[model samples]
Target: MSAPIPVKVHYHKQARELELIYENGERHRLSVEYLRVFSPSAEVRGHGPDSATLQVGKKHVGLANITPAGRYALKLHFDDGHDSGLYSWDYLWWLIEHREANWADYLDRLEAAGASREPLGIEIKQL
Candidate 1:
């Protein structure tokens, strides 16, 4: 099975959503926060096994830009200054297919680490 080509890619700033339409007739809508935390960059995925970094405080991260990387992938720039990951077509398809399970795993990890998705400075103290 060949990878599906993206027919349309639209970023909705206000909603912080990246909408993708594929030639195979599949449409995937992903949140900016999800994309940030799951970035395929070395900073997030790391250079080696057991070195992956957990991204936190990105619940409100927004899309700044999206640039095509040759004919295979896309470079996503985030409002929080992250612009390294190159999201490939295959990767994107995988993301869309496994979003729910992946998100659940992320939440579980965050809970295990006592991490909050809320940005640091704006966090409210719960006394």
Candidate 2:
């Protein structure tokens, strides 16, 4: 792909929503939760080809901070205490550009694996 330029970054910091406007006139609105679950970290990616942490219960997660990595990437810290991924500008751009398709695929994979985005709510009663 060609070089990607972020023409505009509209961040509703309090709401944890980021909208990136690309130089080519494409706009992408992404939720913080989506970004967190897809983080490119060893904690999430695991080792080599036989291990990967199945990230769950991140539907309510949000970005705690967004730090620049040198001049070409973003290091995102999630409110859930995960902060070990350096997201390249190109990676972020790709995520934004293919948000819908990727997210749909994510959901499909979750379903195929008998997993869910929502955790079970437990109720305790005094008996």
Candidate 3:
């Protein structure tokens, strides 16, 4: 297979947006909400198959900062303080390329399961 043409990644913390500028000079904007819900952290992506941890309420989350990892990948620091997963060039590229389709599928999963992206982890208080 041919190698990727190499792309440039840019993060705007205030806007909670990430962009990938491809070799072809095309740029793609990736939203913070999308990155959070699809976080690659161990907290979200488990060690093994079927061990995936589904994230909720991340639709409004955004990037806190970005750390460079060598020259082929990035260490994404989410506003939620998650920085475990290292997003490789291929993975990030794939995400940027397929963001729309994947996000739609995620929403569909929630709807089909009668689930929501709202918080389910809030502590309840006794009346």
Candidate 4:
């Protein structure tokens, strides 16, 4: 009836990913860049529809920390200095379910906006 809470939450620093394991033996991993780009914070989500601030140059973003926000959500601290956003259990599950589609959508948005995921000051140019 309710969203399932992850039984285990692990951040793989080397892999730059967050791993979630549910009680039902389901597992999911979200990249740091993906999490950073899709943060629930108003800075990322904006105040309403069509108002979200496009996050660019976050491919190298790392998780500085992940703290619990009471018992219902998580407060993610990104190394890039973004500390807002409360990722609730329902949202996490939703992300797990929609990872692929969400990623595709994000990429499409980036393309439309002429944004690059590479961190600022670093560009890969092929001649």
Predicted candidate 4 versus true structure: per-residue lDDT over 9-127, tens digit per residue: 99998899999898999989999898988899999999997899989999878888899988889899988889999999989888888989999999999999899888778554322
Ranking by lDDT: 1, 4, 2, 3
lDDT of 3: 0.74
Cα error, candidate 2, residue 99 (Å): 1.8
| 1 versus 2: better lDDT goes to | 1
Estimated TM-score for each candidate? 0.91, 0.77, 0.78, 0.92
Candidate 2: Cα lDDT at 25 = 90
User: How does residue 87 of candidate 4 score in lDDT?
Assistant: 93
Task: Give the per-residue lDDT of model 2 (tens digit) for 24-83.
Answer: 898777888788777888887787545766676677666667777787777887777799
In model 1, residue pairs whose N, Cα or C atoms come closer than 3 Å (at least 3 residues apart or on different chains), thus clashing, are none
Residue pairs with clashing backbones, model 3? none
**Each prediction's Cα lDDT score?**
0.89, 0.75, 0.74, 0.89
> What local lDDT does model 3 show for residue 64?
65
- lDDT per residue, candidate 3, 1-127, as tens digits? 4236356678876677888787888887788777777777778878875887766666556676788789777788776667788877777777877888989988987787778776568633222
Clashes of 2: 0
- In model 1, what lDDT does residue 66 have? 94
Q: Per-residue alpha-carbon lDDT of model 1 for 24-85, expressed as tens digits?
A: 78788999999999999999999986899988899988877799999999999888889998
Ranking by TM-score: 4, 1, 3, 2
Range of the 10 consecutive residues with the lowest summed lDDT in candidate 3: 118-127
